[model samples]
Target: MLVDKVAEILAETAAEVIEPRFRALADGDVSEKAPGELVTVADREAELIIAERLRGLLPVPVVGEEAVSADPSLVKAVCSEPAVWLVDPLDGTGNFVAGRPEYAVMAALIKDGETVAAWIWQPTTRLGYTAELGGGAWRNGERLRRAPAGGGPAALRGVVLSRFMPPDLRTAVDARTGGIGTLAPGSRCSGVEYPRVAEGDQDFTLFWRTLPWDHAPGSLLVTEAGGVSARLDGDPYRVGRDVEGLLVAADEESWQQVRRELGLRPVDLA
Candidate 1:
């Protein structure tokens, strides 16, 4: 499939441009996009490479994290385009920059407000995940099924965005997860977290920002893997929409459990 070929390019890009620079960034290889938001030479190079290659695969518009960050208008363009490819060349920049092998390359295909395809590749772990809209998800080409239910507070594990929330909401959001489940050490990279949940290593993950490049691919991965995802408000994850947040679980049952425990209002997935 075209998506798989894109993944190959990403994996190769990661090997050539991203991995070599890991923990060995030069004086100018790193810079601040804004305080606490980092960008590296590898990210810029990788995206250009991916975008250029994707254009060859199809004429659709290609929007990347770095590109969209520089031009907010691109965000609008993406929202209105018939189809667009969204890329996060290197997620978990913090982890990658800090010498951790936690970042990844992610891409999603959005058409008519829906994400129909996604690819996420974790280079260090050599784990690759892909999903086609109606088809089930796969890891290294093996079919996947999210972990089955049973564990409650003691066995639960997931991602929580409270720490990244505003001061007022942070405390409340953090408290909401208290005692409900353990949070596995996050990669700080949706590329990893999204797959972790879908693969059943984690039970759920909540994000405060539903950026297309970040959540778009992962949302499809979790959902197609037999999990469920939506805005905390019960809206299904839609590409190109700047949503407040997202909640994904191994199953709808777990999704509701987490929402209720957090004191969030619930809506039926159907």
Candidate 2:
């Protein structure tokens, strides 16, 4: 009941709040949170809108990326809360600033240390994805199902690999897969890869690091869409803890072959 409403509001509010900001990108005020990291006024404004609307739904705490950077302990504390809203407003600020269409407003509902619901709204196209625990995933009100497109090691579409990934791992990935297409959209901050995999835009999404707010929403989205997400060691994802490394593949065959090539164990299988 409440969960259904949460998914609906997230899809609605995100479109409403993010539209104006998208129009103002050229003239938007941009600032750096650190060297090479940026945030726009839209980020703050969008986050404010999201947080306020979420607060109306419940008294649960919100841990936003911009808000938590000043004091990361807030995230640690929120993980202890029975319910918390995790948000990454304007994820892919670089892409947003460069006038690309990959940016999004990301949010997830975490309860008892597990993500139960998530929404990823791509403001430009008005495409929104939502998922609830044990409930199926949806894109624009239609249920999502994964399609196995990439055929074996050679026919994969774009591989969403981060630049922050280790060189050795990258080498291993390249060696096992011949002439694989690589797509580095940068800043996996908002779970961009998760939905991309679900929609068959990308065959695989790899992460050498994990952020709770960033990954939680997309994790459920990907898995709910019939894909599989696992830690580098191949364990089922459990946020509020470090993944050591993470990899999300479109199917079990992809997961098994990729993990074996990297000499990494899937967390839960073995």
Candidate 3:
């Protein structure tokens, strides 16, 4: 199957390109793409390797995060492509560069702007997650049961989008999340947190950057595992959508709970 083949490539890419460079980055191996947005040698090399090899696994366009950063047009290209593969060669470059162990390789197959299949591989843990639209989610090949709905903001536990939030909104979110369950000490890796959420160890996660390579796979996995993912305005998430950011919950009930806590109605958010 293509997922199996892609998984092999992901494993190989991590073994050869990503793992070796973790905490071993030489001088000049890191540069900022934009302020606070760091890209490392591992990110570039792994993404290049993934782009080269993953493209062979399928005929569709491989819209890798690093590749699209170089050529912004590819983001638009993905929307029109009949099908596309979005790859995040090295998620959590910050943690990896900092010698933290919260990173992974993530990929998703998007057909007509919807995520149909997804995979995430954490090299350090050698743990893997995969999901198929409506086929359910799995961890290391074990089928996952949906996590139950959380209590409320106070019970919500996971990441939030403070980095991408506006100053006032950031303060508000900080206060709101502070009132809730503790924010999971982020590995700064969505690949890490997404699986944590799927396993029901974490509650909800919010993100202001809706990067396809970042959210596509995790979104499907969270939803398939019995969580809910949608924009703040209470709309279902769609790949390549130009929405501001996203909210993921233990279930639809929590999603709306967060939305209400934020004082956003669907008419305003969506």
Q: Per-candidate RMSD vs. true structure?
A: 2.5, 3.4, 1.7
Q: Model 1: what TM-score?
A: 0.94
By descending TM-score, how would the candidates be arranged? Answer: 1, 3, 2
For model 2, residues 159-247, the per-residue Cα lDDT tens digits are 54536556765575656544444544544445567888888877777676677877888889988988888887667787787645677
TM-score of each: 0.94, 0.85, 0.94
The TM-score measured for candidate 2 stands at 0.85
Query: Candidate 3: worst 10 consecutive residues by lDDT?
Result: 261-270
Q: Candidate 3 on 1-270: residue-level lDDT in tens? A: 876788888999999978888878899999998888899988998888888887787878889888888888988866898899899999988888899898999999988888999999999999989999999998888998776765777787777766876677678666765466567656678898788878887777888878888888898998899888888767788987787768888888777777766654544434
Predicted structure 2: lDDT: 0.73
Pull out the clashing pairs in model 2.
233-265, 233-266, 233-267, 234-266, 234-267, 235-267, 235-268
Prediction 3 global C-alpha lDDT: 0.83
lDDT of 2 at 203: 71
Clashes of each: 0, 7, 1
Model 2 residue 171 distance off true place after TM-score fit, in angstroms: 5.0
